[model samples]
Target: MTWMDEFWRLNAVFLVILLSFSFQGAHCELVVSPVVPTLVKAAAGSTVTLAVSFSGAPDPTVTWFKENLPVVTWTIDSSSPPDIAPNYRQVLRMRKDGSLTFVNVTRNYTSNYTMKMTKSGLGTAVTYFTLLVFDNIQNVELHLQPDPVKEGIDDFTLQYVMSQGDVEQQMWFFNAKEIKTDSRYSVEQNSLVVRRPKRSDTGQYTVKLENPFSTVETDMNVTVLYGPDEPILEARPDRPFYLSGDSLSLFCQAEGLPQPTAVWVFGGENLSHDGVLNLTNVQTSQGGNYTCMVLNGQTKEQRQKNMTLNVYERPSGNPVCSVQSVNRNTGLQYHCLWWGGTPLAWLSFPALSNTSSGAGNFNLTVTTSDNLNRKTITCVAVHPVEQNQCNVTASSPVDFLPAVRTTFDLGEGKIVVTIQCVSEASPEAVVSWSKGSEAVISGSTYQISNNTTQLEIRYYNVSSFLLQKYACTCLNPLGSRRREIQLRGPSISDFRLFPNQARTVVTLTWEVPPASVVTGFDIQMKGPNLPSENHNGSQIRGSSNKYRTIQLKPGSARSADVFNLDPDSTYRFRVVPKARITEGKPSEVQILGPGGGLSGPAIAGIAAGIPCSLLFLLLLGGFIYLCVYCNKNKSSRQTRYPVSRAVEKAITAQPDSTPHNLLTGGLKSPPDYNRLHQTPSDRSVALPTFVPPQPVRVATTV
Candidate 1:
């Protein structure tokens, strides 16, 4: 067993030596710093190096491929320069080390790169590089969803968009601070999502896009639209009530994304449009509920708050106190009043210790036995602003402001006299009238009206009415008063004016009745030329050549003659009698001048017919004488002589002596003296022929 085992072991050792020698001669030991399949990144349109190093070969070949297609190749100690593919000829570069480099790299140059090192007698070594050519991070923009984010009601997103570059990592920053993902915040591929945005989250947001070669960032401002919180209203001087003429101010506060605006409403109308409300000199009419409303225009939200205010005022003046009689003049009532206030004033009597609240008037009653005469009474008025008082004195019933008035009217041949009396007293007075100790009653002659305050007396004869003496009495419970009144008569009658033959003198005459109460007479004469003295020895002047006045004593005669009158001028005379109480009406008369009557031609004709008239009269007389002589018996003689006697009487009668007839010419026919004293009715059977007098015309030698 030893000889056969020994022979096989020698042959196996010899075979292991021979195999080790062959492996050593066939392959070299090649080494590389990095393992195969390494990853590399680059940005587009920029310079990059796919860095790799090997220590086994001195001259190694580096080759770059894009998707398994060769782009470029470089080798040291080569007769020709490095070779670049037609697509990458202008942008391919080679470094001194065994690493691949690219100038102005593009996205299309992303692929695997293989490096192989080989020498004449050494074994070849190979390494791989996985290249990722990414475009530069450019055109980075941050966009917000919904444009404007809403608080508490909307989900918002912040996203980034790029045009050419790729991103390896994405980050979000809020106001320069990093944002973390949570339940409310989520990070997607290139966006950050917020579940529900809030007002506190409103600010600037930044987003970053990162890769191996470059990083790009973009910023955007985010605004959260929120609701206007419940509005808070406050008053400057907080109070439930305010006095009149006081100033007030109000403020409203709210919060929102867009600044909120406030409006003040009062009495169903808008008052202010800002946060502050101002009122100067407030009044009672302005008291009511005031509402403050806040609005957010962006969020379309509104809130409101309300407050109430009250205004008060005091009475304008003091209280008034007065006393009046009541219960048939048996008792007295004291009254107090206060007026003009927002709320009713409170009135009271300090002396009586009585109060009447929430009212403006108070009254107290007492009997006459209380002895309140000439005593002072006080009334107090209480109000929110101030208190005031007034005083009054009580007095007994007495007459005051006593007055009497009298007037006269004449119409329809009747005279009326009205007498009125007035008197004032605390207790109303009773009025009574009497005429000469006789009570005046309402009858045909006397009329009483106006609660016996006016008395009217009617009479047909003015002479009888003037003789009455009326007395008016006003009586009350305390005292009595009386007034006396007397009336005057009317004008005088039968006023006449007489002119003498020369027309140079005139006489004025008037008569007063026996019942008249005349004291004197005032005679006024108006003419072209007046006299210097009257017939009664009274003086008169003609200074103005227009008029003159003469006054006579009561006992003087009724007739007055004016001397030194103009012969060619006319005159007018007026006489007014003065009575003890009043003046009578005036009586007027006019006296004509010398040439005021008949024309000159008529006078001449009358003178010419005088001779013919005398001749006719002579023949008529002769016939009458013959008839009388032939009738010798008594009866025959009486009958024939009646005509003759009448003729004789007409020739021998004198002119009338009255001033009226003397001023004018005498009557054209003779008047019967027997019928002068008879009335027209009594003398109807044997009426006398009356001829009116013609105006006097004196003969002038021209």
Candidate 2:
């Protein structure tokens, strides 16, 4: 062939190959009409078609399935009719293009339909369709599980029911808003379940049932029975306290489903039935707790709130002001008092610039200056309802008469000393007793009688008693006076020992009464050894631990000096007053060696350390006791045999009268078998006497 002929031939072959590929590509591409599937709906007596179209093969084998079951099969190019299943043979029909048609459609024909196509070269193409047949959405009703739902308690359901048609889709709405399924709400088939409905759930609820052919909606008005919330109580012209004849008005409010009603109660009496409680000309008897109770008629729930009212009265008549002298005529006290009122009246001294207001009773003290004499003071009393004033005049101060009397009485083989103090003053004085610098109260040694005006010293010992002085004082807010009393007797006073720098040589001094009372004084000394020299410069070495006497003549100075004493030894010295016929009690003193005593701080440290040491020891002993007890309990638990529950119950039921055999019986037998089988009259029996075992003692030689 020529070159042009060859080119034409190659072009022809290439064009042919391209044309083959184009034809294969066009035929192999499967296209289904309306790629997204949609539901189909029709009336029961009407005809319907589940339309599905695909272009993959010209003579593909087509099969239709209803809910995964093959209902019909047909070939597009076959001349014979389509094959249909026995159940759908009467109502179902298939076209040559593989579309399903339902003739005289009934409610039973509604189902899911799937169309699948298969050819030799091409694989498979599948499409889905849902069919629903309905007559008409009529006689539709929404029923609730409970006619009246209880909030926060009952689980209620709203079910949609139709007598004529089937529902394809259902939706719920509350108060015009769609209700979404959540923890509190759920949709089950045609029912809407509300778990634990609340008060907020009370409203109009709508359920919409829809199919492709029709949509129907039903609404229900649900009222949730709820509580009458805590009543809101309010009072007009509110105040903490009110005066007599005051008016009061109280109002109560509450919110509930059925419109709660309020009732008023006070002091166990029904005051009112309405929300408003009015009190006109209220008296003190009406002051108390007032309750307002709100109730819901439908829910049968009630709530109450309380309010407190206090009524007071102003003071009657006039205030009284009095003046008295205090502090031993050095100052004057002016007092104002207003009594007989519900609440105490307020009193103030306007003229006294430094005084503040007081309740009921008020007092003002001023020094006894020239300005205070015969001065008139005014006391003002104020109350919520009224006010009053009074005046008092201060007079010249009066002097008080004070007297001290001593009386002697014999009792219990001893002489009792009684000291009495009498003071005549306005606003009576308080009497007190003191020994030296310390105040004394009634104790075993001293007794105070007659409202603290008389003091009795009982069981008197002359040696220690004569060394101290007693004082009685009569005191008031304004002033005080004191009187010193010394017991009359031939007794030594102020007995003291003065030690030298070496603490060996010492000097003794004392006080004594007149020479007529005491004839001569005898100085007695007892120690390890007698002093080598006395106050007269006489040397004497007496026997060890023997009493030595140093005599002093009457009218002599009460002092003595000793020399050459042992510093390591303790010495006791006694001074005795010798009367004309009888010897008086002796005053004694003891001197300790420098190395023989503990200091004050050391003694205090020992005293404080004793309790702490004792506490620690007590805690240690408790811990050991707890450990022993726990171990003993553990051992007992380990060694004890197991007892049946029945036996334990029986033993507990009749613990004191349980027989010994019942305690030791084996677990195979029932507890209290005889008691259970016996009649009431035959239950009583003779109980055997129990004897305690004696303890056995074992003796061993050490």
Candidate 3:
């Protein structure tokens, strides 16, 4: 190699050794003195300090850690260094000697504290310290003696107590205001007392107990009791007076600390022990002074109330009903009365309020009618418990008689006879009709009215026999009455035949009936052989005759002509008046013939002479010769010669020894044609038969 290279290599080795020596001289070793302990104790709100010394060249960096976390770090700075952060600088401070100081330590600062120191180009140094912080005093409490203080009776006391802590000061407050101890109120170490505590002393009281580290406060409430007010008395009826049989009740009430009880007294006698006193159906004897006493159980105080009750009597009796007077306008007056009732408002009746007098009497006038006759008058006296009553009935009598009337109506070719029977009775009367001796049943020919007061008998083309006597009888529960009325036809009078017209055309003239009640006339003519008879045998009448009816105007009195009659023949005639209901009695008969006054023998002789001219000549001649020769010119001789031919034959044909002379012949065979034409009579062959002539009857009525 070259000289220059070797020389430089030697110089380099020398510089390297010099540089190693210098580095070894500049490096400093770490040394720790005054080691920190594991645990340190401190009081709450007190300061704590931690100190440490460490040696190292190129100054070592120091830092603090708790549970391996960095707490504080200290380092040397050249220029313009940043300020320490607030959290670490507030509670802890770093010194130039690498120690930490904690000011006013609390429980939160009781964890492990670590210190670290740092220098340029050197290793770091750290120290740890554990802290415990405690407070000896705790939360304060205030208690009260006589918790519910009774006002005017209790002295109040407030006691204060606390935990194990050093308390430096204690203060008292009432209602959040500072309280200074005085004569009225005083305080001890843990209690306060008030002398003669009034209701004003009942309020909230507080005690503030504090140590060097903490302050604590507590509150207590006090209450007091007071007195009740005076008692008040009340009554249910609200009135002091009452009538007999009234119900009464009393009440006693009061407001107090404790509820009050009542005692009731009547006229100095204790009656009840509750707050209410009730009396029912009170009498006059029970009326007196009543007192109610109220007492408080706890306060031992009492009150009294007094009242008086008055009872009056009410009148009672049975009501009396009497007939007062008869009123001209209204009728009968009746009055009801009761005497002397207190507060008459309680007594009542339908007519009481309308009375003319105020003496508890009622009057009413009733009319005399069917309603009054059946009515019962009543008087009522109303009372609270029961009602009094009195009643009377009215009496009346029946006062009328039966009346009968008959009416005739002619209409529609018929005649209606209405007979009405009526009577006035309290109860309606029943009426019945009787015709002659027989009862007239209603309906068909007889139609009775609804009330049986009227009966109507109807006839069409009525005849004389229908006229009759009718009796009407009316009956009720009280009595019976009868009335009779005759329904008569027209009266027939002056019945006769004209003498001049008696033989040939007989013109019979008759007077019309007296009344116009008749509508027609019936003419009955009986021949010599025929006869007519009526209902009764009072008049001579003959049956087997000819009848003819002739209508005439009503109310007319005139004559009728009858024609076509036989000559020298005897006839008897009668006329019956016809009405709407029936017929009247026939007129007396009149005989008409050739010689009107001739005897039956003369008539027969004349009739016999009418037949056979030869016998007529013989008889006439014989009669004349006898009259001349025998000197029998008397009326008896004339009568004896007038024998009918049939009688002559019977007399002449008799045996000679039969004792049949002229007188005997006259005695045995007198010739009345009706006697010879009997229903059963014998005739002789020698006598010629002769037929009696029949006449045409033409009857008319006016």
Model 3 RMSD vs true structure: 30.9
**Would you list the C-alpha lDDT of every candidate in the order shown?**
0.67, 0.70, 0.59
TM-score winner: 2
Against the correct fold, how does model 1 do in TM-score? 0.35
Q: Give stretches of model 3 more than 4 Å off.
A: 1-139, 165-189, 199-205, 236-251, 258-702
List, residue by residue over 1-702, the lDDT tens digit for candidate 3.
Answer: 899999999999999867755765675545544455657767777787776777654345556775666766656332323234466567777666666677887767767766656556655555567776656567567777776565566577888767666555778888998888897788777788887776577678888886556678888876544433465777678874677889988787776545667888887788889878898998877777778787766656677777666665554667676652254323555666765444341323343234433346666655555455535666666643345677755433243333322234545555665666676543355677788898888876888888888887776644532456778887643346787665555666676656553364455556643222455566666653321232452434222345444324242334555454545455666677666446767777666654464445764664465345446555755664564344422432342233467656544454332121111212223233333322222232222333333311111121
Candidate 2 local lDDT, residue 681: 35
- Residue ranges of candidate 1 with Cα displaced over 4 Å: 1-37, 45-130, 312-702
- Give the winner by lDDT: 2
lDDT of 1 by residue, 562-595 (tens): 7776665555677877543356787755545545
- Clashing pairs for model 2 are 326-478, 327-478, 327-479, 328-479
Residue 62 of candidate 1: its Cα lDDT? 59
Better of 1 and 2 by TM-score: 2
What is the Cα-based lDDT of residue 684 in candidate 2? 35
lDDT order of candidates, best first?
A: 2, 1, 3
